[model samples]
Each structure stands twice: as C-alpha cells, then as structure tokens.
Target: MDEQIITNELLKRYLQGKCTVAEQQLIADFLDDPNNLILLHQIMAEQTNSLWDSSADVPQHDRGQITVWQRRLHERMEEEQLIPSDKTKPNLRKRGIIPIRQRIQWYAAAILLFVGLGALLWLWIPQGAKPSEQLVHQKNRITPGSDRAILKLADGSTISLSDAAKGSIADQGGVKVQKTAEGEIVYAAVDKRASTQSYNSINTPNGGQYRVTLPDGSRAWLNAASSLTYPVEFEKKERRVKMTGEVYFEIAKITNENKERVPFFVETDKQVIQVLGTTFNVNAYADEPYDCTTLLEGSVRLVAAHSGKSELLKPGQQALVGNNMLLSEADIQQNLAWINGYFIFRREDLGGILRKIARWYDVTVECPPELSTMKFTGKVSRSQSLSAVTEMIASINKVKLEIKERRIIVKK
Candidate 1:
C-alpha cells in the first residue's frame, strides 16, 4: 500500500467505523508492516498539527463507537498474530520501537496510535543523559507532597503545622488544639463560654493535605490547596464552617441543650450544604465549572449561594450548583477517592485529570486546548511520585507526558 494514498479523512472514517468491510481489511493489511507504524505516526502528527491550527476541523467521534471499533481491531490483529507476544517485545525494540512494558489493552493501544503519540517523540531518552542519570534526575525533580498546612489562630497568630511538634499546638478560647501523630488536628474544649467568639482556620497548600476534628466532633478531610475556617467551639444557632476548595466531611451528630440534633453547615462561595450526621464530599475548586456535593451517607440539603435555590440529596446522590442547580445519582467511590489517597477517573476528560495532577503534584500543567476532549478511565495511587504517576498515565493512555522542572506539558 502506498503511504501517500491514505488520506486523513479516510483514516478518520476508518477509526470512526464508517469504513466498509473491504476498506477495513485494506487498513488492517496496511498496518501489518512494523515500519508502517512510524509512517502512521507521521501522518497523525501532521493531522494533529492541522487540527491545532483550525480546531473547527476536528472530528467529533463518539467515544463508545471508538471503543467498539478499537476492540474489533484488537481481536482482528490478535487473530492474525500481528500484536507482538511477550517473547517478541525484544524484537520490536530492535526494530526501533519501544518495547511494551506489558500487553496494553485494546482501547489504550488504539488511542496510543491515533489520539496520542507522535512517533514516540517524548518517550525517547535525551541524547546526553544516561538511563540511570535520567531516572535519578526525575526522582529529584518530581517528588510527592508531604504533610503540610498553615493554621491561623483567632488571635491573628499563625502556626506552620508541618513544622509544629505533635502536641497541643494552641488554645483557642478554651478549646485546646492538639496535633496528633497522624498529622490530624483535634480540638478539646476545656471550658464552655456561651458567647465565645473565637474562630480558627487551616489552609493546605498545593501538594498538601490535612485532616481536622472540629470542636463539635465533625471531621473534615482537606484536599490540596483547600481551606476550612470554623469557630473554636460550636455555638449560636448552628454548627457552620466556611470552606474553599475540595473537602470530605464526616459530620458528627451533635445535640443541643434541647436534645435536638444541630445541623452542620458547609458554606462555600457557590452553595451551602446542610447536614446532620452525614458523610459527603464537596468539590468547589475555583477553576471547576460547578460546585459539586456528593452525599455518601444520611442526607444533605444544598442551597445555592446566590439564588437560594434548594435541593435535597439522598445518600447516593450528587448536587451540582452552577448557573443552574442539578441533582443526579452519585459515584461515591469516585467522590471520596482523594480522601482515600487515590485518583479515580471514570470516563473523565484529560484536562480535568491533568488539573488534579497539577494540584496534588504541586506543578503547573499545560495541556493543548485541542486535547481537552480526550478522556481516560483508571485509578492511580496518590502516594506515587509525580514521575511515576505521569508514567503510568502515559503507559495506560499512550499519551506523552513531558515534565520540565515544576511544569508538565501534555502533547498528543
């Protein structure tokens, strides 16, 4: 088959499953040559470059249809003995193709060729750096975040929790603030002053996470670049806290003097979530399109901060507050993934995933606007180093993740 004869439109149709059986067979045969893979990379790279220049020309292929087509391609290639087996990986490497660390699944392999990778440009080792030196350099540059946060006292004093000893850090009003061995802050009230007007706030930096047990016994798990401000003691009409960014809350059922359960309220810029002994995750990142609250237990009432529109969310529901409020079924595990130290993506876009990578890894991510539509599905450990996480994402999706200093560039 002549390489010049394959048009970008034809390849797009084949990938989109609009090609006839005969045409599909032709593409299959055309892909049989090991060297042809490199040629395809060149064609796709040119197409991608064109897409960048005029994004209006980008194809709108359905992901479900693409998945079906990719699975068929995998099955056909396997039946024809085209996909290299474990023993043939070394041979592929000898032919100037990087050896597959493991057999990549159908969807990943398909996207690697079409949606990502331009001749394995970013994966190749630099000319001067040895493999061992590159490994060492990556380790030193892209390390994981540690226990770190800033605690602001009501008296205008600030404490660096990361540097503070594991003991009583301070006393707010009569509430003794104790930093536990596990890096969690717990509040113990020594005296109950009915009109105590003391408040404290803890803010976590990018690449930082922390937990706090409020004086009312509610626990808040703060994600990277988040902050929580609350009174030192539960007073007044309700237990309220102001929050920014993402946090998971396990509310404690607190009873007032009348033996009635006091409602716990989480106030963000977009909405107010009211609960009584419920577990929920709230993501109100300033950059995200909506303020999302996912209920995992009990119930929650979401009140839009501006319009005051209210919605009641059941245990397995989520409320998204944006220009308009929406309620839908929730994915509890995905909502709480950060609290459990993992990044979970279920058909999430590459841009959103990279935004999270930027936060937790404490790095800036520059993703081409054209790659916004690329989606991924997987779960990665939060404990992994930035290099390991990026490598895993690249391997699973076959995309090139370029890390330079504290900045990451995603290239297709």
Candidate 2:
C-alpha cells in the first residue's frame, strides 16, 4: 500500500474504534515497516507541536504516559527481532528475523501499542485540534439541520413548531393539534361534527425537517424545504393530502361505516399517488427534472398530472414522472435516506447530490456545467457539520469545494 494512504483522519478513526476490520489490517501493515514507523513518529511530533504552543502547559502525567508507551514500543520491537538488542550492538547487521506468522503476531502487538499512543495523543489535544473542529475552523462552520417547521392553521395563523411549547398548540374546528415531547406534531379529532374541509399545513424551511401524525393515525415525515397540506380531519370516504419537495408517508388503512378500506391520495405537481395502505417516499422538488415516487410497502398507483399516464408500483419499485412515466426497481434505502438521517448516493450526479446538501445545510452551490454531470457514490451522516460533509465529497471525487459565506463553489 502507498504510505500516503495512512492519513491523520484514518489514524483518528482507527483510534476511535470506528474503522473496519480491513482498515485495521491495513493500518497494521503500514506500521510494520520501519520507515513508516519513522514517518508516523514525525507526523505525531508535528501534530503535537501544531496543537500545543510553547507556553501551553501540557500535564506532566500526559508527558510521562507518552514516554512510557514509546519505551514499551521500543522493547517490543527489540523482542520481535525488528531491531538489534543493546547487548548485540556489534552484530546489528547479522540479526535473524522471525517467521511470517510470528511476524504477523508481532505486528498485531505493535498495532495495539500504536493504538494506545494514538488514543493518548487524541485525548491530549485540545478540543479545537480535533478532526471535526479542525475542519470547522479551516472552513467556516455550518451546522446540521434540526427538527423545525411552521404549522399553518385554517384561520391563516402560523405557529412555529420549533418554539412552541410541548403541548396543545392549536385547535382547528374541533380538531386538537399537539406538539409532542419527541418534536413531532400530531392531530386528533375530538368531535365527530368537525368539518373535514378545514385544512392545515406544515412547512419546513431550508436546514429543517419535521414529522406529523395525521388524524387517521398515518404519519408523514417532511424533509428540508418541504410542505404538506391536509384536511384537519379526513372525510369518511378517503384521506387526501398535497405536498411539495420531498416527504415520506406511512399510510394507515381506514375503513368507513361500510367496512371498506378508504383509499389515501397524495398530490404532487407532477403526479398523483393513490394507495390503500402503504409506505412510500415522494420527491417532487421543482428544481429536479422528474418527480419520483418510491414504494416501500403495499401498492400504489401513480398517475401523471399532465399527460394522464399511469403506472402501478409494487414494493421496491419506483415511478419517475416527467415528460413520460418510467417504472423500474428502486434503491429503497437511497430513496428513504433523508428520513433515516443520512445522505446516501449511488452513482448519483454531482448536481443532484449538491442540491440535497444545499437544502439540508441551507447553502447555495455553484457548479460548472461540466462538473455538474460528474457522478459520485458515498454515504455521509446528515448530522455532520457542512465542512465535514463537503470535505468527504471533495476527497471522494478528487475535486475541491470552497465555501464562501453561505455559498459553495465547486472546482475541479
């Protein structure tokens, strides 16, 4: 392996116990080389110096701990026949080496020592010197989004869900709207006489997300910069809702007085989806070329709003509605990643991926027309800071992403 592959981030991940078994083995192999050991020592010294100035008072115990670990590592190297013993100074060039399996065992022991030292170094560094903090400081920090939205009642009043107290927030035509302790908005019908025509809407701004439980016990999760409008109470015959941007739904089957299942309907600009009881995700952002409806459970029928073209979607199937309706098997996990708190991309174009990042981080992106079509595949936690995410993207694509204030400039 290239010695350059052993980066500070990789070492930090190894020390944090976040590396895969293959990564751990790679690290072990890198450390087994004597020249790489010297390089690692230099890296440690440089990092330590950069983290602590001359006037900084590092604890005496920390200094002693580092010394002890270094001595132990030296002793281990001598025992493994990797270095000449002090008593054999005259025969340094003629030392015998161990067998391959035993050498691997020695490397494993050495890895433990290095891991211990790495842990100590990590703990000794100030908070500002940590990997995440370093990224934040290098580039201005932009925090991840949180659960926040606006609830619009039928009376034209808006309530900020982020600031509302954890209790009843509004009462709309005998329907009680509540803000739960878990940061979700729920609606319950308290009176049978309540008019089903009364409507309510929830709007999530950029860098925000929210979940709402409808009157029929169904749930909807709204992603960043999305909106969902539904009646305060469903009519006896059916439940219907209109939405924009992206939303995930877990529809509940309801039966009327006749004991027949009432169908649920979702209306987007490009398509309308009808389901009996199913889980699905709808991506209807106006900026994208197509509106995608991915079904996870049960069945759904998607009909294009303009052309009247229709298609039935089964579990793990997706219908992409645009100039024409196309149905195919879908990457269910990738489609539902937002609800699961991740940005999972599978050979997705750079423009598509950056659009998601811009929405979640509330930043604008400027990508050249040529680079916009470049494809990348990676998964990153949605909870990470914007710098960490952009850094990962830049590294994966061998490109550069520069952040200026609230905008990102992509360059090759």
Candidate 3:
C-alpha cells in the first residue's frame, strides 16, 4: 500500500468524526511526515464546512475566538513560505545586471502599479503591464439573508409574498392572516381551535425571507430559500414539523393533559431538533451544503440521523451537521437577527460570510484568495440593495468592490 494512502485514510476518518485517541495520535504522527506537510495545502483547500446566516453580527466573545484562529492560520501560512527550497532559478531580467531578490521586488512593484492604475494607462504603455496580477488575498463581506421566496401549501396553493400585498390571506379557525406590507407573513389567532388537525407552511426563495405566527401562538421566521411544514395546530404527546432552508421558532408553552411539557420537534433532511417550549433556529436549506440548528432561548437536543450522535444545546448554542458534525455555542441574539431584517457579521471569514451573502443576494462572487482567509465584523440592512451593503463593508475592509450588473467582484 502507498504511504500517502494511509495518510488520506486517516484524514477521511477524521473528517467523518470517527477519530479516537489512538487515531488522533496517528494523524498527528502522519502530519509530521514530509509528504503530508506538502499535502496540507491541498487538504485545507478542498475541505468544506457548514454555516447558517442568522443575519446578525457575531457576538463580541465569539468574534474574539474566531480572530485567534484567523491569526493562527495567517501565521502558519507565513511560516510555510520561509521553508528552504533548492528550486530557485536565476533572474532572466537585464542579463544578471542586478541581484535576483532586488530585481524581483522591482518588477513586482512595477506590475502592481500598472494593475492598480487603469485601462487608460494601458492605452499609453502596453509593455511591462502585467495582465491580471494579484496582490493580497482580500477577504469579503457577508450579506444578510434576502427577503425573496414563494410560499407553497400542501394543497397546491402558491403565495408570492416576494412582491405582493401583505394583508389578510384567509380567516381559518378565526385566525387573521396578514402581511405587514413589509413582506412578513403572519397569522393571528382571534378564535381558539378545539380541533387540532390543520396545517400551514411558509417557504423562501434563493434570495428571500419571511416571518409567520402559528395558530397555537408560536412564532417563526423563515430564511432564504427555506420552508417550514408545520400544522396550524399542534397536538398532545408531541408537536412535529419538517423544515427546509432555515426557520427560527418561538414555541408556545404547552401544559399537556399530564401537565408535563411535551417536546416539539423540528424535523429536517438528516436530523431532528427536539424541543419542549423554547425559541431556536433551524437552518436546513436544500441549496446549502449542510444543515444547522442554532438555539436561542430554552434547552434543545439535536439527534443526528446518520451517526446516531445526539447533542444537547443550551441557549446561545449552535450545531452544524454535514459530512461531519461540529457543535459550538454562539450569541443567540446576533444569530437570530434575521427575524428583524438585517445581517450582522462579527469577524466572520470572507468565504464563510460570502456563501450566506450569495444565497441572500442571489448573486455570484469572485474575490481575492487572501480575502477568503481574512475576517470582518459589521452590520448591513437586507432591506437595501446588495451592492449598497457590499460597498459599505468593502470600504471598511480596505478593499475595492465592483458590481457589474448583478455580479459582485472584489479587488485589492
């Protein structure tokens, strides 16, 4: 067997959340190998992780933790560049008229200057003009979730709240369903329902968002390209609902026949969030890479379908489920701000934030590689244009942002 095969297997196991004490030590030992050291860049480049847009800024404490990791990544990359190499070649400029390092610095500066200038400069001087050379990898800003989506019912009824009148849709069980003209889909129970077999659902588009209230007095907010399959009224024993995309819930307190709190379940593609009477967010968008459950108020438990691993989350905690599972506590307030209509990024990674921004803005993004590793902390309104928010963020981050039509590209 090839030595690299053993290394790759170890990485696979690690990513699968199957690493034991012995296996972790094995991976550490293999990483010390020269061959593995060379492959570290490849591994980091290809590995993928999961995230959810709360549309809120990261809390101060969480931002600090992320900043430490960001600095560590930067330092590691800097050190890697210092590794001794025997592949150095002589300079081809001016027939060895100057030192190689000096010539390189001079040429690099000239090339950078030309690119930083404009096409007008190109009209004058075509030579020594490096075509599309990059300087630093600039991290980008994350846009908030969009307010665009269509609502489809199990009965084949479609509600386009993306650009429609926000007012009473129907009066079922004496419930007043209205839109606030702000595109917030809401339900108010003016009359009580003794019989509990009715259901309703809200869905979001690739660049949309919405909010609604259940007949049982509970509230929910749906994120971009997401939907919630919940009954108008819950039942005894347990309350269950299926979710696609993302939705934040404020479950109503239920004193059952036994006077015990019956658990509420948010069912998704791969896992289920079991709750009794609490507020939390479930982000399980089909368009996203993975599913996430972020808890805000009260206690909740996440049961992973694939690994059979169960996680209990406290208020202000989050669980990310995908090819692997990662659980961490976050700021509940900042993570669930979507219900209010804005995005708050607290020292978030460029690529990480952009993924959410891309989904919300319904736009494609291409940025400097360095930008992907950098982090930003800020706030922007999702109510305005995506470009408007991007400009605000780019200005603070010392990056140049351009919007050619709907596409957003960042330059340094």
Best by lDDT: 2
Q: Return the lDDT, model 1, position 246.
A: 94
lDDT of 1 by residue, 276-361 (tens): 89999999999999999999889988899879899899988999998889999888878888877777777687899888989998
lDDT of 3 at 338: 66
Please provide TM-scores, in order, for all candidate models, with all chains considered together.
0.67, 0.69, 0.57
Off by over 4 Å in 2: 1-139
What is the C-alpha lDDT profile of model 2 across 1-412, one tens digit per residue?
Answer: 1111113453435545664332233344345566434433333433444334445454554445444555655565656655544464333124332222221222222233455333221111111222332212244679999998999998899999999999999987788999899989988878876787888999999999999999999999999999999999888888999999999999998998889999999999998899998999999999999999999999999989889988889999999999899999999878998887878877678899999999999999999988787666556668777876776555332457888898888876
* Comparison by lDDT, 1 against 2, better one: 2
Order of candidate numbers by TM-score, starting with the best = 2, 1, 3
* lDDT (Cα, tens digit) per residue for candidate 3, span 1-412: 1100112222223334543332232233333344323233322222212111233343444334333433443355457662234474223343322222222222122122112111110111112322232222224533445566676643567777666676787665665667776666676767675245666777776677777766566778777777888765567778888888778889988878889987788888889888888988887766566787887779988888788788888877789887667888776646775666656666566676776777787778888898675566545456655655564444332456676555678776
RMSD of each: 14.6, 13.3, 19.2
Candidate that beats the other on TM-score, 1 or 2, i.e. the better one: 2
**Would you list the C-alpha lDDT of every candidate in the order shown?**
0.70, 0.73, 0.58
How far in Å is the alpha carbon of 340 misplaced in model 1? 1.4
Off by over 4 Å in 1: 1-139, 193-195, 396-398
| TM-score for predicted model 2 compared with the true structure | 0.69
